[model samples]
Target: MSEVLVAFLTGLTTGGLSCLAVQGGLLASSLAQQIEQDVAMQPRPKGAPKIGLRSGLRPRPQIAGPILLFLGAKLVAYTLLGLLLGLLGSMITLTAPLRAALLILIGIFMVGNALRMFNIHPIFRYFSIAPPTFLRRYIRRTANREATWFSPLFLGALTVLIPCGVTQAMMAVAIGTGDALQGAAILFAFTLGASPVFFLVAYLTTQIGARLEAVFMRLVAAVVLILGLVSVDSGLALVGMPSASGMLRQSGSAGQVVDVPVTPQSGTLILNATNSGYSPTLLHAPAGEQLTLNVVTLDTYSCARAFVIPSLAVEQLLPSTGQVAIIIPAQEPGTVMRFTCSMGMYTGQIVFDL
Candidate 1:
């Protein structure tokens, strides 16, 4: 539950900039169309001039009504799409290796998009998914006709097909969930989280006649680039490498892998799960002894909560603030055990070198 909340908040903060890049223009156009219609419908006093672009902009709080409808439509559409994706995900069970590969691929795509934002090389063209020309034309036509309800709703629905890289990343997670309810929840929460920013932008532009500044746009681009780097870091973690943030820095100047800390334990081996990752990523245990692995989590909402030990076929979802224990069968000497998160993003190892 807490993990879901984290996902929603993640969308909220990141969507302010990331979603704006993808859906800002369409929303702005819809607002403009709505404002024009509102002004046209107003009865002008005798000898009064028509409202021009620079004319007195009256605040129309009613604009929020249609914008809310638009957001609601988008939330429904994305949630339904997520359900279908989740159903498909269940059909094709994703193994750790495959999931890791997908994360890395998506990460690369995000990085490329970030680079393109700064006029860097377009590295991953195939990942770009643009809505067809017909869809764009339809949206424009609806706006021109001043179909207030339909235009915003339809445009919002269409945005599902033309999402930004951050959205694509979340979609990949949705597919990985493999549960209809979970998938729908994730996407619905994400869309809901993004609504505030979109609504605010529309309100300011249409009702307040505020123009988007170039400086603000540059800041958004910088944020997108940072998100891209974070995505890449997550991908690296899934692939069993060091995080790009240097949380798991390489040991030597040659960039050699750091020695995973190994602790010898008997009976129950207790481990703490932190926000960065599992403490003591490496462990040493006595073989041929009945052992229990106890994971203590305190308010953890990151991917690490979904624990997995692929080699042992053990998968467990830890609570946000509690302890979960796994009974480990006696293992043979010299056995190396690997444990990871659901996506293989956070990993730890247990060595039985007796």
Candidate 2:
């Protein structure tokens, strides 16, 4: 539930604006004829000042029908995409290394996308994904044919081919779920959350001018850059590498050692998983002793429930409220094992002491 909510909020904020920047052209083209017709149908009273482009007067089109149809098709398309991604994920076992690699790759793409938005380098423009030339020509031809009910629907579904950076990030998350229903739910929630912003911006850009759109794109670029960095950090953490946050923590706690907790039962350590994060992020235990690590979760619905120990190739989806025991073999002195949520958003470590 918490995971779904987070996805929803992400869509409402970053996803909406980012998607608009990429796909707004399609929407505007789809409604071009309709907007013209609406403007034509408006009555001009005699002796009234002439309304022109410079006059800042235009008809507000009745666009609810077309917009809803477009959004509905888009929602369905992305949900099916999520289902397919989840099925693919379930078919193949994604090990920690593979998942880490995927995360890093997606992160790089997102960062490149932000750079492209900023026009930092001409090479960064390659980060923009587009349909094949033939397909693009065909879609444009079809969109220009007429303002029919099918135009918006077709364009909306086609958006799947040219997803924005944030949408791609969410798609990566859907694939990580490894469950079709859950993946579908996540995408569905996200798309629904994004609809309002998409609609409002589309309406405003058509009715008003491009100035607002420019400002929104700049904001989207910043958000995309931040998300990209976070994704890279998460991927690094997943592989037990030194990440930005981890480095900061290490620097802050330099020369300060965390004492090994005395276990209630010898050779067993207990850790709690909550909605926020893992408790006792640092732990220590005697080396050369076989150990049982018990993970307890009570009403936890966040990503923390998807527990992972990357070095051990261990991945477990914990129940909302339960205890799961993981057996660890005897380790050499000075051995350090790191654990994190599947997305690497939450993390902890256990150090084996002599």
Candidate 3:
């Protein structure tokens, strides 16, 4: 459906870019480890005494297998987590205070993690629930010494524990979906979107010995910090605080209105809905005329599917791909009507001028 497609596309583009800072280093490190292991296991030439340790190292192990397993595991984990979050959301209505507290806590955790990544100080490391020394040793042994087929899969699964502000943000939105399927779909799409970068970076490291670790890590630190601030603001907005994000505002726009040339005979206007957002978000219409708002949606599988017009008490759910017409009563001049998605994340409006 459109929702899943849109989610996938979003993940492919913006989500993938955001993930570079979060998972880029981890993917590179894992791939490098696998390559080193593969090189050490290269066959020794006949009658050739090993000149040195790991002499005549074989080429790095084909990353295709490990990368596939890693991404697949992440996809499954994210989808499952999303389903669980959605179920929990359906069971309890989160009060504003509770939601804000949760968001703020998540934001603080992200900020602290970012600082830790930057090695700002040793103290920030203590803020997280890190495994004990013994547990870390066990993990390292499993990954390095054993070198079982499960190593890449295990590492991918472990990514769920690593702090990622974008993932957390998506998790919050998934909770609003109120259904397991929708939640899973959203996360699956996001993970899929991020997979491309994971594969690309991993390939570069293994294929060409790319040395971007330092640069990418710094970029990740900056992104995590920004995401932390955004998370905190979103939480504040939940508690009746004015939202700093312009996407959620309900107030009328003062900008010049788009003059939509409606059909003179039928007073009809056609609007297209895409993944990025609604085309022509603001429209100007003539007053005192019956109007048909024909919204043409093609594979729209996003929050925008839940259309709303607060002033007219209009709430409509759009199909994944189709045309839906809503009757708009003749309005008095100077009237402005606003419509948004169910979460109020995406907005549009109609202005009637005499």
Candidate 4:
């Protein structure tokens, strides 16, 4: 439940604008058709009273029906895709290394896409995802038809083929769940959260001029860049590599190490996972001794509950408020083991002293 809520919030904040930048064209096209029809249906007289200060009276097109149908179809399509991805994930175990690689690759793509939005380089233009030329021609031809309802519904479903960067990130998360119902629920919650934003922005873009749309796209680009960097950092942490935060911490400490007391025989170390991050970002213990690591969470409802130790291949979803014990094998002197949340948002490490 907590995970789903997080996903929903993510969509509401970032996913909505990012998706609008990618998928708004189709919606604009559909709306253009509706406006033209409405204009043709309502002919203005030469001496008709002016509706606004500048122009004669024009019919206000009914757009609510089309927008609702489009969003409904989009929600259903993504939910089904999530279900399929989860089912496939259950069949094939995604190892920690593979998941990390996927995150890194997706992060790279997002970064490239953002650069393209800023017109950084010609090569970055290739990063844009769009329907093939042939498919686009078909869509354009079909959109010109008289069946207004068919165009919006078809285009809405077609958006699944070209998901935005944020949507793609969510899809990866859905696949990671490895459960059909959970995956479906996650996508459903996220899409539902994004619906209102998508609707309002897309609608306004069609009614307003292109200047405002350009400003909105710039804002979206900035957001995509930030998310891209964060995803890359998370992937680095998952692979036990020193991420940006880790590097900063290391520099701040100036090579100093804090020793944590542990029994010569089997020992126990307590670590707290909080909503913000892990407590005691680093720990030191004696080498060549078995250790029991107790991860405690109290009312933590974030990704921190999904504890992971990439070196040991340990992945456990801790309860909202409870403790989970992880047995660590004795290690040689100077061994360093890194641990992080599943999303790699929160991280810590334990170093064994000589």
**What is the alpha-carbon lDDT of model 3 when measured against the actual structure?**
0.65
User: Could you tell me how far off, in angstroms, the CA of residue 339 lies in candidate 4 after the best superposition?
Assistant: 1.4
Q: Per-residue CA lDDT of candidate 2, range 1-354, in tens?
A: 666787798789867766765665566555655665676788878876655432445566777777777788889999999888777766756566776776677678778877887778899878776556675566566655744566678778888876765576577678778888888888888888889888876665545544555565567678778877877888888898766765555455556654456384677888889987777677888788889999999999877888988888889889889999999888889998888887767777888874
Which segments of model 2 are wrong by more than 4 Å? 1-7, 17-70, 83-92, 146-151, 161-183, 198-213, 246-265
Please report how far candidate 2 places residue 51 from its true position, in Å: 18
Winner by lDDT between candidate 3 and candidate 1? 1
Who wins the TM-score comparison? 4
Model 3 per-residue lDDT tens digits across residues 1-354: 455675677677546545544554445444555665665677757886543212342264678877878778878888888788777767755443554566677668767767876889999776445445674566567777766445567657767766355566567557767888888887888888878866775554445422454455567677767766666665554443444552443333345344576777889877766655565676778899989998888977766675656666666768769989999999998987666554444566677874
List the pairs of residues colliding in candidate 4: none
RMSD of candidate 3 to the truth, in angstroms, is 8.4
Which model is ahead, 1 or 4, in terms of lDDT?
A: 4
lDDT tens digits by residue: candidate 4, 81-108: 8898777766765566776776677678
Give the alpha-carbon lDDT of every model: 0.65, 0.75, 0.65, 0.75
TM-scores for every predicted model: 0.65, 0.77, 0.57, 0.78
Tell me which of candidates 1 and 4 scores higher on TM-score.
4
Question: What's model 4's lDDT at 159?
Answer: 78
Pick by TM-score: 2 or 4, better one: 4
